[model samples]
Target chain A: MQNEKMMLEIQQKVELIERAAQAGTGIVEIGSFVHPKAVPQMADTDEVARRIKRYPGVEYRVLVVNKKGLERAGAAGIMKAKLTVSASNSHSLSNLKRTPEEVIKGFGECADYAVAHGIELSGAISTAFGCPFEGMVPLEQVMKVVSCFREMGVKELSLSDTTGMANPRQVYDYCLGVREQFPDVTWNLHFHNTRGMGLANVLAGMMAGIKRYDASFAGLGGCPYAPGATGNIATEDLVHMCHEMGIETGCDLDQSIAIGRDVQKLIGDDRGSFILKAGKCSDVVCS
Target chain B: MQNEKMMLEIQQKVELIERAAQAGTGIVEIGSFVHPKAVPQMADTDEVARRIKRYPGVEYRVLVVNKKGLERAGAAGIMKAKLTVSASNSHSLSNLKRTPEEVIKGFGECADYAVAHGIELSGAISTAFGCPFEGMVPLEQVMKVVSCFREMGVKELSLSDTTGMANPRQVYDYCLGVREQFPDVTWNLHFHNTRGMGLANVLAGMMAGIKRYDASFAGLGGCPYAPGATGNIATEDLVHMCHEMGIETGCDLDQSIAIGRDVQKLIGDDRGSFILKAGKCSDVVCS
Candidate 1:
């Protein structure tokens, strides 16, 4: 009953994706192709991928843990897949049942499968900044993961602060160091608002010249391993900040806020979305 | 009955202030010396000031709106006070029943009273970043307030984002501009987390060479005029970020978090305090 109630149907997932695309989101991580028993909420990912009315100029991607997940994503007609490995061994073992090194070693098969299936592969290093069980993930571990991704022919990569352990200084220094070390690769940042430093870290990344970021609608999604942690930074909050700072994000602020509100209603709880609660700055009237 | 319940008696206020001092807070704004009818919550500020066990080296200050408020603070034996004026005319009119210019112009009497009473006075420009009633406050208006504060012999000033409407770029530029324009004045930053940009704005301010900031314990305190706005950035969250980034704030993280949790319980609600919800990064153990 819990699973049934918590899960979204394939049609609902597809509709949400379409809505996001219509709201001018350039890229959408549709769902994860994990074991149905492991993540029953995403059990209908394949069906959702097949049903989505794909919008032109919008890139649709799915999370694929291994070669099998990639095959499933390919079978569902998804063109882009992101393979992830935790930078810390404890988190990797706890979440994926493999060490970081072991996970990267196994990604060779996934890379070959993606190439054969004509899938565009991107990489994500979970807990790149820090891990829930392992306090601070060292820069060396993140560099090793980046090296492995580069060796696997992944040109686009993201460093994810899985439990929001990243601070602005660490983000700025790390982004600058990584960019200098790997100039050819495109780096993206993913941050959680667990410690209220998500937007601050994003500002740091921007200062270091990192252009891409990963944020969640309605600030949905949290790490199961990180107890009492909040979700990712809200997409509307990021977009709102970007627009306010004279940085154009190409996303409609009102529509994004609407989507966040709808998602909040569906979840039946308050997500960490500030814009949804306070309305946009522009919405405030001049007295 | 409502006022009695909401108002913290002199003894309780003293206890809270002493607790904050024992927790290693270097500066504490004990209470505002506003009229009892106007702000019943702070009606006992004078009594609290007289009763508290003052900590040596820890500066105790109270909020004073005018010369009468300053006189009351002086009579209560408080040695430091903060005088606030909104940078936006709309916010100034709504909160103080005077325009920004009028409020600043009236501060001459406050300055005279502080000098006669031998009290140190600091100035704060509310809505310096953006006004809730008037979307964006111009830098010229903020500069004008700064000039007035300087004229009134207030060498220390803070730029407060009263409604959390500030973006990082705006914050950085404004901080840089104000510091350049008035190098002799000691500038501080204050932010609200209403739109989730409080810490981000703080980060920008720090990047632009700001060393002092004002944050609320348990993130308590909101603007009555700014609809749906949350409170100031949590003090614990700021200290946590500073510690993680290797910046010395001289504030104990664990103690601050404990105070935040206590305040949360006292208020009978969940405050916008990140560190209170999630333990410090050091508290996370490696598995």
Candidate 2:
């Protein structure tokens, strides 16, 4: 029954990825190439990568923790791999069983492997804002990780609020600081709606001139440390807000909402999607 | 049976209001003095007003649609009454059975009654962002209502996103435009999380120099026009963000979260409170 459920989930993810590409998503993180025994949910990421029909002009990426995960990703014909580590030592020790420095040191081998295989590599710093076991991660700690990624030739970097403990002011200040310090690197923001500041943090990052953001369908995913927390900012909700503000995200709002609804049904519960529940702003009624 | 349930709800609300005041809430909108036939849930606002233990520093207020509602509020010994109208004519027609202009015109009598009875009156414009019956309400329409309120001797005003259709850019621009045009008016913002842009809009308003936000405990309030929608931004979530950003809101964050949890248990649902669900950012645990 577990294998059957995993197979069904893999097929559903493929369909969701196709629908997302059709809705004009520029990039999609298909899945993480993690140990199957540790995360059974992402056990079939290789199969998912092989089955997805790649859309032209859309980048497909996967999370890789080390050279082994990157090798698996390359074997699955994945072109882009994101190397991730928790910036805070407590989260790093808890989740990865190593300090942040040790994790980044391990990424050196992954970076070299990606370069040798002609695969694009980016860096992601998890718990860049705060950790469940530790309060706020210092800016110096995050900056140290960014500097390491830069030295490893990673140009695209993401600062992820793993526990949704980020405030707009903190986000804005951190984005501004990073951009000023690392002018050549592309910055992305990943925020969870844990404390309901996901969109607010996005707004702050945008004001600080950061563009790329990561969101999940129907607001799926949550922190294992912060139990009962909501997931990343909903993609449909984010697209709706951007379109309403005339920001031109190059996404189909209706299609995104449709995908959100489909994902909610697939999950057998309301996944905390705002646009999925409230409809688009243009969905006016004749009251 | 209905009366019994309502009486229980009334007692719960009194407890909630008293708890909120103890948690250092500056202003509390206790309830609406609308017709009981229209809104049966708020039928016992008079009783709620009479039963609550008032705090010395906190101001207790209620919503009043017209002179009749204002009179009822006065009879209940409520010193502060907020006269409300919809900025969008379509919403006004649907909810109030009149146009925005007509509603403001009628507020003249309300203003007169408040003055005669020594009741402090403020103005609130609902659907100031967008309306369910109309997509986007024009800024001029909102300005017209503000001008009327200024003429009616209402110095404090609140612009409410009734259906949560506001984007951050729109909020910032609108707030800037209104502050520039009406320099003397003290502005507050009321946003719903109908589309999950509530906190984002609040950030925009703050960036544009507007303070004084309205939030509900446990996020317990929804748009009747937009079914299956979330309510106002949770007060605990907002205070948590403010405290994290180093902005002092004079609120006790832990007490606010406790009240949110209590409200959720009373209502027998989660009610979409982030802090209530995830605990505070300070809630650290050993891994």
Candidate 3:
């Protein structure tokens, strides 16, 4: 019964993804190839990847943690895969069952698999801003992970605030530091709104010249370790803010908001998207 | 029964203000002197001002809308008062029952009363960002209000986001404009967390060199006109963010969070103050 319910939920998610793609979402992370027993929600990753309607020029990406995940992605025929390693050793050990050094060492086989399978691979450094077990992450340690990914021939990288412990000043300074040290890498930011600074961090990243960010519809994705925390900055909220500031995001704000509202209904939650409740600032009809 | 309960709440709020002053808060707006029927939450404003314990060197400010409120504040023995007028004519009429032009025209008597009584006065431009009845406010209109305040001999000024509709880019640009145009004015910011952009706007204001901000304990206040809106940024959240950024706010974060927790218990809600729920980031101890 539980498996059937999970499969139904997955189907609903894929539908939401297709709608999001039609509404100008260029890239979507369909699911993660973790052990089904460990992350039950992602148990049907292969089915999701296979069934999700891929739009023209849109990338359907899956998260891969090890060689097994990479093989699963190949089986699922996923063209793009994100290989993520936690920056903190304690987090890496607890989350991935390996230390950071061990994860880096083990990435060789997975990188080779992606190269051979014609999969476009991108790297992510989780807990780059902070860790639940480690209060503040050192810049040198974060840079070390970046160097390891660069050594693996990855050009696009993401810095993940797994704990939502990032403040605007830290984000601005760190983004500048990373850009200065790794000028050739395309850097993306992933922030959680656990401490309610997600959008502020986005502003800081924009000030530091970062253009790419990771957001969830209705802010659905959150850190499993951070209890009572909210999810990533809502996609509609981010797009709405950018558009209100006269920054062109190339995404239809109203369409994204409608999809966010629809996703909220499918998930039975609207805790993440403020626009869902408050409407747009511009909606306050001008006389 | 309702009036008695409101009086009790007012007593509790006065105690909170006293505690806040002891915790290094140099200024506190104890209550607003709007019409009792219009804003029943502040019906006992004169009583609150008369009863709230005042700390030396700490300004116990009351918000006054016109000559009648100014007289009531005087009778309450308030030494410092904030005379606020809305930037949007619609908001001014809706909130103060007078047009913006009428409010300005009426300020002359209030200004004279303050000067005669030796009351240190400040002017606030409410709805300076966006209006519920009027979408985006023009910078020229905001500047015109600032000029009118300056003409009335007020040096301290507050730019308020009456509906919590201000964005970061608008804040930064407006702060710079205010600083350049009114170099001698002691500029203060008043923001609401309605769309979760309050702290982000505070960051932008700080980047543009604003030193003082208005925050509500436990985020206790919101515009009655802005439906589905949250309160001002929580004092604890703002102070915690500042401390985390290495900025000295001269306020105690733990004490403020404790007060916020207490306020939540009193109000039977915890919708504001992430720190009240998530605790401090430094609470995570590294092994």
Candidate 4:
């Protein structure tokens, strides 16, 4: 799908992207409010968010770091925003430069701002299950943050393993704990394959009745602070699993690979995914 | 704990290994049936199976390629033996010179041999979720294989998405389908992270009620045919997840890492985990 001559390729890409967005998979995260200096590729997230047109069935979301990030995201036409607040204050200071309480306060600010402007907010707690800096994140601490967000009127939640440090057993118990305490919040999983347990954690979370997992294209772009991991679970990989098991993700692996391949071409060797190295699981050979 | 001589200090390692194995939440995969020429690392499996004294409760299993492999394995002195039959003929032919049917026939032979010898057999349908070359394996085909194995009087079953090509949905539905069709067979999971969805697939599978899983230390051994994916989920990473969620794995992370690190020193950098690069998630500095 690459055009070397650049002859109206922008229009073609736009069309391809339009179709992808319209395919309707519930929620598709496009970008996050990451520091440009830390991740230059993601620095274009604002522009990427702006260029993406919303279709009827798809919910476009972006990750925001702070109140200012929320403002920038809103201006970029982001209808749904997910904010990060780490349970491990150590991880929070390293990643977000704020303590968990300060992050909770920031979420309160974002909720007030979003309500005033008619924007929807979903609170994403990074390292909810475990922290890279903190060996084991106690269930009580995770409960503290979830309760704070619930009190702040942020009803939607996204629990993240941020570092891919969670296992299936922990995922089940952790998610069950959260779901029992905050029965109304809709939460998804945010896992990285840092330690190669991303999908296993997803299974653990799902067993606890949590649906909607987050992944990146070709397993690209994990947190800068969480060094050594490659990416979130690849988008095509997730879709392939769902399709095989009869879950309704509403995504096409071929189409998603096409999307990821395009981005990979742009990123060059910085992105890592074995599927791209080999091709899709459903790929065929012909003479 | 290495000494001045730079070899694995055995006594310390044994104590650590024993403590970790005693934890009970971990599974040790003891063998692989790939031809010795192809996967030489697996050649020492018998020695590995014999040298390691098993604790009272933890499960110890060895891998078998075919009936011939089972015979060699039988002399190795293991309580349990695992078997594999690839779903794709091309891969089977290339890797073992046998079609899926022939491999299953081998499984039947091995089953009889195991029964006669009073050895427990755990059947692993390798490349079960999808094949590296063939692509898009039919569920009916997988079901047929399962039924065949069941009829052959196999006791336990392991469904391997060896290529890391499986998704949560596929894992969930596939496990559900197997559970419904063969409620008596207790199933385990063997996932690769070629596409970064190994752990996610585990999550989906767990939701479907399968608990036991198989993984290597530090994500060892990538399938040469699956294009981009590597081998099983890392044992240390998997243990980290389990311990984090308060799920009891009979292994410890520090101990597992020591093993992974030791193996890495032996292999000297080709296959290992990135978490080893960035260090542990708990390495964070709290404010």
Candidate 5:
């Protein structure tokens, strides 16, 4: 029964990837290459990666926790990977069983492997906004990890509001600071809607000239450390906001809403999205 | 029994007004001075206004739908009133039994009353952003109403997203246009959370240099015409966001939260606010 469930999950993930590609998603984070014993949800990530058909011009990325995880990703044929370390020391200790400094050293080795194997690596600083155990994350702590990525020649860098404790002003100020410090790096924002400021933070980031953002279908992902928190910002909601703002995200809003419905059915819940409940602004005609 | 319930409601509204004043709210819309037969929800406006103790320096404004409503407000000793009419012709006819043109002509008499009685009068353009009956509301239509108010010497003006169909870009552009046209007016923004863009629209308005906003306590108010729509943005949530952004809304956050809790208890539901569920971002400590 367990084997059957794993296979089914893998197949479902592959279908999700295909749907995501069809919806014009340029990049998709398939799964984390963490220890299966620790994160059982991602146990079939390797099989999913091996079995999934890749769309042309679309990049598939997996999360690498350490050098061992990077090696596993390499073995599983993941040409692109997201290398992340928690900016909060408490989060690092709890989630990775290592100090933030220790994770940075391990990331050095992982970055070296990426360079050696010609793998595209994007460095992400988790808990960049706040931490459940650490309260407000100072910019210096986040920049420490950012500087490491900068030193590693990581051109693509992401800042994750891991617990979604970000406000618009904070996002605007942080994005401005990052742009000033690392003008050459491509900045990506990863937000969760745990506190319901996800889309607002995205708007702030856009005002600060950030065009790339990370969202999940049906807002399906959540932090294991933060209980009662909602998942990532719904991709359909993000796309809806963008389309309404006249910003062409190249994603079909109708198609995205359909996928959100499918994901809601697959998960057997519809509590994740606002656009799914309130349709598009243009959907209701005043007859 | 109906009279007893009306008295109870009047008492509750009076208490709510006092609490809002204590929460550092400078302006509170007390009630609408409409005909009791038309809007029974506001039937006891005269009694509520008479019984409620006025907070020093806090302006208690009532809405006046017509010249008769203005006279009733004057009789009730309401020193401040919001004179408003629907921007959409269909909404105007349905809600007020008048065309948009007739409402504007009647507002001329209401404005004259304010000037004669030395009462502070602000004008609100209802459905300035979008109308459910008219779909996308043209800016020209809104400006026509604005022009009428401008001609009537109404300097304190507000634009209301009555159906909550506004996007950030649209808000920014419209506000810029309004500011350019009515450079000297004190502009206020009223947003609804019906589509979950309320806070985002507030941010946009703030970026456009708008300092005044309208939020209902516990998000208690909704458009009578738009069924299934959420209420106005919660006061505590608005205060929480402003405080987080370093903007002084003069509201006590903890006090506001307590009031929100009281309101939740009073209303017997907790579906109105995000802050009521998540608490403030600074509520958690890193220890």
Candidate 6:
């Protein structure tokens, strides 16, 4: 019963995340707030918020889908939260089952939640780079998404290349456009390695002066919608890239790789990660 | 019969190469100078030289084993040749069956051939950063190996992080030492993605001012000695990195990926490459 798929326990999720945070997990994305009837896995955000383990330097963020989700996060003492507004009109409708107008108005409520509680908010524009259903995601459309979120007083925003369909050139062009528009607004890159060019796109972001990025340990968190899409770039792999470029990540590779293994084992899937299989090679000595 | 691996027929190879050049096969490695009995595939150095489909823009490089190998290259009318002296002494013994002393002495002989034929040589110190047989390859040994080739008037060199066992810190430190030792020498890098850090090492290489790199199409080439050791960095992947980062590669990723698929068909191995499976993810929209 424990290993059975679709038999996931919400309480168990709270416990696993608590242990994962204790075991040195970095950048754990706690939930994707949607309809209670839609994604049952994300149903226990309020309870999970109360049960989560908070590391000294870790950011324990909860996903807020609407005013109700934000209010629940606030009630659970989850101060900071992530809010998303999808670029694809169809994706927005299917995910939240709300029209784009409803979604933006809903985020207007999120801005109210932020002002009342001073909640640290990270606004994200999903499918900013591309969409599985719609095909091409325009920079203009993404900019409009961010522009609305910005007007609602949202500052730190992430452009999610959600479907693993973004190329590095598009990343460069799109990111450059965003950076030019935002100037100093903080943005994180959330790219899926589904097409294997995630790291390449990361490089594109770096060249565009992007410092903050979103990476899941062991490359976890695939799109349930896209058939073969994997999660964001592996954290260890990303940190390895930063470390190799003489950039400071302040994270341990060995520890990260270990957690990646743990997450893989917990998920009961052997289909993830490049760093764990290939240990750290940045310090070999040939004599 | 036509598809057999042992067939590097003179006329056939020349004709094939002529077409390959026309089809944009710019850097074709003609042959390695290992003993004819050992890597029998490289026995056609002379024939390759005699009937080369010489193209002014493209490079035709032969790998030299010893002084005798250089002589064969000269007679074959090759202009550019690569001389590799390993940093891993055990690999030196196993691959060349010679001690470091014998290899250096052979470099002296190879130099004589280069000077006699006006050949431009780029010395490669294999296992410069790591080795498979001997876990850690010493930096001094690599520099020493490089110095041996340098003493023979080989001013240009490429560092081979053989088997993808090198790390970025080591790459940075080692390249610093190499830069100090051979101040005016032109240097390139060779890396493998065995452990999934191929591009990380490339970032380190680019940081070290090493621009020219060696990558196989669809990540072709691996060691028969090391089990599960995959090929070098994929050319399309590398080109994508360069193009996205605003680095000029003078290569086309879409065309390269097409070539990769063609080569995969030719070799009958479909298990290589990530970008080929995932396709390019840059700004260029793909159908």
Best by lDDT: 1
Better of 3 and 5 by DockQ: 3
Task: Put down candidate 6 lDDT per residue, A1-287, tens digits, no spaces.
Answer: 11125434667677656655665555566675556666666766677778776777677777777777777777887777888878888777766678666788867877887789867888888878777667778899999888888888788889998877776678878989999998868878898776556776787677778888888777777666544456778887877767655777767676777777776776787544777666665433233
Query: Per-prediction RMSD in angstroms?
Result: 2.1, 2.7, 2.6, 6.7, 3.1, 4.7
Q: For the second chain of model 1, what is the TM-score against the true structure's chain B? A: 0.96
The lDDT of model 3 is 0.83
- Model 1 chain B lowest lDDT segment of ten: B1-10
Q: Estimate each model's TM-score.
A: 0.97, 0.94, 0.95, 0.73, 0.94, 0.81
CAPRI classification of candidate 6 = acceptable
User: What's the true lDDT of residue B166 in model 6?
Assistant: 71
Query: Over the true interface residues, superposed, what is the Cα RMSD of model 4?
Result: 3.9
Give the RMSD in angstroms, all C-alphas superposed, for model 6.
4.7
Q: Score the docking of each candidate (DockQ).
A: 0.75, 0.64, 0.63, 0.37, 0.53, 0.26
Per-chain TM-score of candidate 3, chain B: 0.94
Candidate 2 error regions (>4 Å):
A1-10, A223-230, B1-11, B223-229, B284-287
lDDT per residue as tens, model 3, B42-142: 88878778788888878888888777888888899987889888898888887767888888889999899999988888989999999988888898999
How displaced is residue A242 in candidate 1, in Å? 0.6
Give TM-score values for chain A, per-prediction. 0.97, 0.95, 0.94, 0.86, 0.94, 0.88
Under the 3 Å rule for N, CA and C atoms, how many clashes does model 6 have? Answer: 18
Q: CA lDDT, every prediction?
A: 0.87, 0.86, 0.83, 0.69, 0.81, 0.72
Docking class of 3: medium
> In terms of TM-score, how similar is model 4 to the real structure?
0.73
Judged by DockQ cut-offs, the docking class of candidate 5 is medium
Per-prediction count of colliding residue pairs? 0, 0, 0, 28, 0, 18
Worst 10 residues of 1 chain A by lDDT: A1-10
Cα lDDT tens digits for candidate 4, A1-287:
11111222334444545656764457777656767665454566676666767688788777777777788788888878887788888888887678999878867778888888777888888888777677668889988998998887888888887776666777778889889888998888888766666656666676689988887666765666754434677776666656655667877777787877776665554354656665655563321
Question: For residues A1-287, what per-residue lDDT tens digits would candidate 1 score against the true structure?
Answer: 11224666677778789999998898899999988888778888898898899899999999988899999998999999999899989888888788989999999999899888899999999889988787888888899999999999999999999888999999998999899999999999999998899999999999999999998889987777655556899999999999999988878888899888888887788878999888888886555
List of clashing residue pairs for candidate 3: none
**Candidate 4 or 2, higher DockQ:** 2
Ranking by DockQ: 1, 2, 3, 5, 4, 6
